[model samples]
Target chain A: MQIPSPYDMIAIGGSAGSLPVLAELLEQLPVSIDCTMMIIVHRLKNVPSDLDRLLSLKAPITEPEDKQPVLSRRIYLAPQNYHLLIETDGTFALDYSEPLHYSRPSIDVSFASVAAAYGPRALGILLSGASKDGAAGMQQIIAAGGTGIVQDPASALFDTMPLAALELCPEAQPMSITDMVHFLTELKMSAEHDQ
Target chain B: MIKEISNEELETLVSLIHRQYGYDFSDYARSSLKRRFQRFMGYAYIGGVNELSDRLLQDATFFERMAQFITVNVTEMFRDPLFYKTLKDLVLPRLATYPTIKIWHAGCATGEEVFSMIILLQEAGLLERCRIYATDLNAVSLLKAEKALIPLKCMKDYTQNYLQAGGMEDFSSYYTADDEHAVIHSALRRNIVFFQHNLVTDQVFNEFQLICCRNVFIYFNRQLQDRVLRLFYDSLAPLGYLALGLKESMMFSEESIRFEAVSAVHKIFRRKS
Candidate 1:
């Protein structure tokens, strides 16, 4: 089946083994893409580093600000020690009250929030990571009538995250990062066609 | 990989809980229950569900412990600050037109969201005209909500959220700090009611202008999400609002087309005419 296009937002979740894969995926995304992107990568809480600087090498990046309006073609990273959630009016919010599975910037929280916000209009992609963090959130995305995509375990740097998501959401499509990017670009094109 | 529990054993456990005890787990999503059971087993130092079941039957303490395990009690105050901020900036103004308002916090765990809503309403000058109903499946969390006492350490984080969500007053003014706990202002609590209500089996008891159920559906399956969404749709008055957790949505449900998105990212929806 041709997946729906014009996704309101794209939510990507990853962890330990995500950097290289994230870099590859970001390189594939065109600067002219017109959808908001929210990325959740598990990280150490107190160790201050610039993910924006890191991601900027591959794509334009922005950190979600409280109540700031979301704009297209910008990559938004979940801040350290906070669960970044998308707001209804197309802005971003941060919650730092507690940690899930001993990790802040949890993939589950971000994926789950986006699943709720965009429903079928949301696209959830799980990349390489350690642990089963994004599994439940992928299930949430599917349960909310959204599409769930995972990097093919065979190609993933660490198969744990994609495997977990596949285990939780059996219908999730498995693709290499290149195929996934092509698929999303085609989706955007098709959505524009229909519109 | 987590050891897979047999379906028969899972069914038997659910049946026993329903027959011997008043609680029902039969309708809960199987995967979620399994994950929680595994976590409970690990936490209680039991080998698996069979041993955990035996302990639950033999020891009341174990049953209580299992209760905590089964319920997804994860929550934080002003969880999606922008959602609350949107309610304050966008929705409350319309709600203020009404002389009186009734809001429900369905699946409210430990009352943080309820208290947060009260604080929002108080700041919006709507508290005097509002009566809030806060319900949750867990009684322990409800009791905590009733006490209105949360750890003082949590105050700093919550205060930050309050400010980020666009608070007009000092965050410290909402509570009084004791040794380790902060007592929420009684004035905010006065118009609030706390009760236990299970979303799976319970029916809507009142019409509401706004109903907030955040992060509670991640523990439920698709059927249950649809069921609960239908319940919320039925519970809402015409043009009323429904807010869900960042991960929860009403897509594919019968009510999906019946409500228009007020804030899609915040999962806020307004009832259609």
Candidate 2:
């Protein structure tokens, strides 16, 4: 199998049953990882206030800076009432102006931006979530020559987002959290080998 | 049967648009172009696509009305505030290093975004060093942009956006409110030059440190998007920044590989080596 290079950034989007899967994935990944990780989890505007704290249990979590430079190995979570975007200089931004897809922290907004900026260097991972938010974005990632991976719908806690992504891009890899971690580890190792 | 619009009808409509209007819908996504044109025909009280095509050839007034329907002119002041804020905080620092800056607001409809950038550059103390080229495909929209005014009711909402995007001073200070209109301050308008430039048929005119074309390309097909992205790529200085709408992506475009993500969440990219 031809493994893609180590990604500059990994953007994951999920909602509903994603908390456990995200926790599991973070726990398995090491802090020494070279890439930046960004996650957007859909929650009631008020309820997920402690998302930074929750994700920080496994990885260092920070609220994205408006136009701040992108830092590697840190996990950035989308703040409430803001859409997170990746800028060209490897920084993060938060927009609180309006909501797309009726959600402030829209999956499509973040994923599409990643596909645009990172192109083939982007890795998009879609997990269990409600609705079809990330479907169109995943297609964009694939079309941009980025690698796309989704949690298996059958294995997902909430199958909607994963299933929607699968429907949109049939060739996307569907893996369990353990397998996904292994895949990323191998990807990193292969990248180092090539270098 | 309802979907069966004859080839002759399609050909006639395409020819009418090219000849009479001098606007080309020939290369637009077929299904979406057809749907929009059909709706335009119905709204204008014309009899179907073929008749609408013929009427366009004869009546200049109908063509003017048709242009409005065909153009996607939706825009907002500081529509993506965080992106503007990023330009202020991150990109402006780099732009400040230069003695002069040229910024382009491509596809600037009605000038809300152009004025928004003007306000941002002013706040950053870069306005005096900057010259903004605000261009759009629709001449009607360009005229509106040149007016530099917005509805008074929208001021409250835009003010809120300005604050959230980290406005250091009062939003009211930037505009003068009279009756139902807010005239943008003359200081902010000094460096802005408004013109009509189509991304599809136009060539790059100047190199820019920052180019903002937000919420516009989502209406375009992939081919057009690629064409516009190339135009932007050619227009940007090396290591210059490109900011797009939240939903717009440079993926599938030739320029995608030539830029790096500065901020993934803000949809900001910088030209690469």
Candidate 3:
């Protein structure tokens, strides 16, 4: 099912074995689409996560600075060891709050903030992961009248996160990478036409 | 996720707080304030935003209870180790030239960073010549910081941070530990004077060669940040150093502000005379 409004903000959660799928989604993003996108992947606290550098082959990605503005047509990676919160003023706030589900940059925390900041215009996508961190965040998005998309559990390498999100938001049917890309492009086109 | 207060209710609550208690939270970042409001509601077992506001309006003591959540933020001994390392390498050497040094640590919540700074000073052989003033708005936090204690379990990580910051000696030697806590050695606590000062409502109290108010600005909006930056500027001695968190900036305020970034990467600035 297609969400009616063009997504003003999008948050994607990934962990375990979701890197390749995340890369594909970012790579296939329509160039004309203009919105803020955040990528949250479960990473170790002290470890060097150059996820942005790895994913920046075609899509230029940045690890946002504290209280940095959330500009359109740019992608952000959740900085390591900091819970990334998007404030309502289209800026980011990073804090060292306690880890949720043993993950410092918990997807749930960001997703909840997105739900609060964007309400119905927020879009959340849950991909492969080994933990249940993003499930409640997806629930929060759905509860706030936002659209949630789950990676097909059958296709996920680690299906735990996708299945967990599906349990909370059954209306968010499993979507394959190609199908998700097609749907996003169509939404971008619709929004552009309306303008 | 808990329900957040509406923007209107949030504004009313902030205004009510300022009017009743004279603690100005009017300029705090609304996003962080909203998050704290949700936490307060959960703590008080109040369901709706109106109910929470009503309870605070009725009970004087409840606002005191709410202050604890608003203040008393988190800190570790050596957050962002590289920032500390830069302090040792670049900042401290110039500070040693003085026969006596005065340093002010604003928003020194629980004094972890104060302890960290003291350790650095002690290593540089400048502790004897230095007088450090550490202040926070929360009385309970000031009392805790005066005790010079930390959780014993956090020592391992802090030790790693110390080593990365080019620690000259063993970090374990600074504290004595039981099963639950590690009390810092009394010798290391000699130079610091901890007190209570509010960044929002307080004015400049003393001039210092170095002033640090790190990571505290993230809780404030741009206007409040500018106000606090001006306070720090007035509190600094001419050509004094002002250190901030990695991403915090002074560029948000007026155009002719008199400080120049000496090390933008480390968030260290110097007053231009």
Candidate 4:
């Protein structure tokens, strides 16, 4: 067995039309992929969020409970109106402070925190969104020497987010939804091979 | 995936926090607690959980910093404006009937909510009769709360929230601002006491007519949530009110039977006689 890659935390942030892309991406991944995934999507507060349930159809997913330990192969969604952060120990930290850019679960807050917690071990992906919220966070991830990925603006339903991210991380690999799925599978396979 | 903090290391750290500091975080949501421990380790520049434990043993200042981290301290004035609006429209009228009003702001970080409550009571003509005990486990936050100064950058956002929450006067009237910070008017600070109190370790100090414990319980595990809810239940006067964060609820708690929702939409409840 090949040694497992240190990159295990996959932090994804998106809004607007990112759901379909997420659904598709998860559907393509093998169920036994040895990584922990966390997704932060703009969501409505007070009303119970069903994003976790909706996405779990494609993969095992849950809204992380306060301080819950992050589990491999399980997908975690930022709870409605909470910013999802990672502690250095790789457990989930949900923050209920004022919404950033009028968004709870602000992509910047989560991305920056994850970069700080995981540094080079983090893999951050920016997806479609109407706003430029995730750009600075993507910069933080790349600055920390973590890999940064962006959805190709041409393929995004809303290109504003990806364009903004590209401005900060010119080196960020832009992938189409289908290509992104293949990339994730290859990365997983490589990690497994190393183990 | 990265290996999680070993259970034995986690237990030793929590035990140290409990034994040395007397703050019982053992019942806090374990996953969140572990996450916080990890963040604390990173912040302290330690490489491992065991190293963090050793540092805690060697350094007293680390405990003080840990107190700040262990209790999450993000808050804003009039958060969830609709909840405040609900209080103004439906709850304040009932509070006005009392000759003297006492409120407890559990986990009152940096005191923004405390000031927001004062503003509402002042506008309702109830400020003169109201006394609020705002408490938190973090002394540094309590000190900041006592100072009544917040970054002026947030005032714009807070102003909008104040208006949406149904402010009767100009929001600017509540504070004086300079280039970097805004200091709440001294008038609103009257009858408000900022103190260090631990929800997990402290006993009920007073029976309150209103308890505004918002957004704090979501950080706790279910067991701790139940224990804290029961404490609030025991500390409330008959027919008193309890205002929770819009996302928090007592429905799943053992004390749920003791109170009825004042406005279920806003998570406000009134103790049933």
Candidate 5:
């Protein structure tokens, strides 16, 4: 049997200076992106956050419960203090495991699990962060034949994370926040056109 | 390498755990449980659910370790210091009117919060009248709690948390630190009782003036959370305090009506008379 088009999931990971860029990116994203999108950012455990409400203005975002189905064409933000994983059946898995790289909602955990669940159909994006947490997971995504993208270090407020990602996936295309939004918009248009 | 566990495989393991050990994990959130099992599998180098089941059946020692792994939770001393401050400023004062106080720290992994509570009681001069029951499903963690030794590395952070929680005295005074570890002062350990108590399979043995079961219910499904909340409610004395993790609340359960929020932002609730 022939496999379907490999563009089922888009996962974005960031930390430190992600909010403004994320807002800009979300603002530019069209309603008909044609795939499931998930965002993971480092957050302090036990602290209440208003991220879901803030992001919901752009697109209806769900802070999915454990075992909830990960549906297509929707945006999901990982709940604070929970390591979000993508199950093989395309559902969300929440883990309260010890913090990885001092982060409970570690970008690494989400990226690796996304790669495992969606394989070549996934696209992993790494943005600004002060740590090298997501580098290995980004590499895993690339190794699994999924596309890996990173914000250009020069444009990122905290360059360590993007630089680390670049070190792991040397061939990954780097884009500024504006360029990333433009590139994704083009990708979505072409994907819709293909249908 | 860890492989994805199929639905059938997951059901088999959950049933096996229930049948063989009488531990009820069936009601726990399925995705979280699967992730935890997968984590254990990765650590133990067990390839698949069948092999995990086989190893668990053959080796009792492995089962003991597995049980520890299942119940182990990541915790920090004086986590969300403001919550501790609320306990000190509001909760503890109300409990002080009682002739004697009984506090239960349910699922007290590694006993950090238990120690934090003891410190609060001690500083308030209420430690002598307080009887603390600290329990968890993991016996290994209970023993570690009994030891009351924290890594020296974490002491600084814990101290900062202590200060943020409004410590009147120097935070370092509560522990004796060497190069590698900080052992809580022996005096603070006097009123504490650590034991193995599985919330899923255990019954309430004592009425408590205050029950702190933070960060435990997030792992459970709604049904399990409701069940546990009811258990907590029954175990609490009239007008007693029930403290939950920041993310957890009784609002989602039928039990919410029976309790009033002492400080909703801090997740402190009191049983209504």
Candidate 6:
């Protein structure tokens, strides 16, 4: 039997035109995937967010508390304004520092921290957006020997984000929503076999 | 160069600061500290974490500069309007009865929120009786807070926030401005005692009727949060009020039992009498 994939975390970063894709991804993913799922989507800072409540319809999506445990089998969404950071010590941290790439919870910030924490043991996904925020982040993942994937530019509502990532990480895999669902299924099965 | 920092290197750096400068960052959230250290590296033109730590140990002034960078200072006047309004309507009247109203603004970075609090006290006619002690971990920030010079460009937004916080008078009356900045009127500064106090290592200095430490606990780890909760609980007089950041929860702390929620939505709690 092929060796089961030992991935423990899957980080997804997107901005404009990504929310619908997230909803679809959540609706399709299995009920019991045992990896820490982190999603960072750009949203207004001060406005109250229903994104968690909206996404929770598919699965139990949550916003992490500072120093919250990075337990697996849960979906963690970034809060509105604060940068969500992953700790190498198996926890999460929040920062209210200045915005980068015109964003508080910058894709680059979270992905850099994610890359630092998980290295090759993680998967990074970049989806539809109009900005250049996630490109450097995806490159960080690839440089750390992690798997980098992007939603195929053809399938993205806005191709700029995925295309930018591919430009930086030429070797990153590009997949459609169907392909991503299949990839996640195989990932889940691989984990089941490993355990 | 694209890689973010690791905890091991950061731990060494933090311990080095502790050993040499007596500035303890052991209880702070490591990820936030690591991010700040990375920015400090860029500012100082240092190459890596090992070198950063080496330079800090080798040069005391550089370490001070590094300390300045590590402390997050994203603050604005009346940053959260509703918090102030709620205090004005709900918390202040209860506090006004005290013979000498002692209020502590813990981790009051740049004193914007402290200024807002003072405005509330003034409106309620409690400013004379209130003795406000505003403290921050960074001396540089404390100095800025003492001066109360806010950027002139931000006044429009601050004024809007003041209105939303139920201020009837013109917010501009609070400050006089230059081309670049607005220095808050000196009268408001009369009762405020500014000082440097480290929440991580410092012991409780005084008891107060209200301790406003919003958005500060977000930088602390769970253990440190618990310890600071104990400090706040000890420093608060019986039935004294504690206001925390909207996201902060003291649920797991031993002091949690000692504080009853005054307003869970506002993150206000009162010490058990």
For this target, which candidate reaches the highest TM-score against the unseen true structure?
3
Each model's DockQ score: 0.06, 0.03, 0.41, 0.16, 0.31, 0.51
User: What lDDT score goes with residue B16 in model 2?
Assistant: 76
- What is the lDDT for A156 in model 6? 95
RMSD of 2: 10.8
Give the winner by lDDT.
Answer: 6
> Could you tell me the lDDT of residue B172 within candidate 6?
90
Give the poorly placed runs of model 6, Cα more than 4 Å off. Answer: A1-6, A185-195, B2-4, B163-170
Instruction: List residue ranges in candidate 3 displaced over 4 A.
Output: A1-5, A46-49, A185-195, B255-257
Q: TM-score of chain A, model 6?
A: 0.94
Cα lDDT, all candidates: 0.78, 0.77, 0.83, 0.82, 0.83, 0.85
Runs in model 5 deviating more than 4 A are A1-10, A16-20, A27-38, A43-94, A112-123, A135-148, A153-174, A184-195
Model 1 accuracy (lDDT, Cα): 0.78
Alpha-carbon lDDT of model 6: 0.85
Q: What is candidate 3's lDDT per residue for B169-214, written digit by digit as tens?
A: 9898889998989999989898899998989888988889999888
Weakest ten-residue segment in model 2 chain B by summed lDDT: B1-10
Runs in model 4 deviating more than 4 A are A1-12, A15-39, A43-80, A84-94, A97-126, A129-154, A157-175, A178-195, B1-4
**Mind giving the per-residue lDDT tens digits that candidate 2 earns over B1-273?**
022244467667877778876887665543334445655665677766667767787888888887876676666676656777777878889999989999999988888888888888888888999989999888898887888879998887788778767788888988888998999988679889999897878898999998988766655556787788888888999998898876456654666898999987778999885
Report the TM-score for the A-chain of model 3: 0.93
Question: What is candidate 2's DockQ?
Answer: 0.03
- Compose the digit string of candidate 5's lDDT tens values, residues B1-273: 256676688899989988887888888766567767887999888888889999988888998888778665678899888899999999888988999999999999999999999999998989999999999988788888888889899887888888888889988888898888899998889989999888887898899999999888777776787888889889999999999876565665787898999998789999888
- TM-score to native of every candidate shown: 0.66, 0.59, 0.92, 0.73, 0.83, 0.90
Please give, for residues A13-48, the per-residue lDDT of candidate 1 as tens digits.
888788888888888764455677888898754233
Task: Estimate, for each residue in B166-186, the C-alpha lDDT of model 6 and write its tens digit.
Answer: 887999998999999999888
Provide fnat values for all models in the order shown.
0.00, 0.00, 0.23, 0.19, 0.30, 0.58
lDDT accuracy of residue A91 in candidate 3 = 87
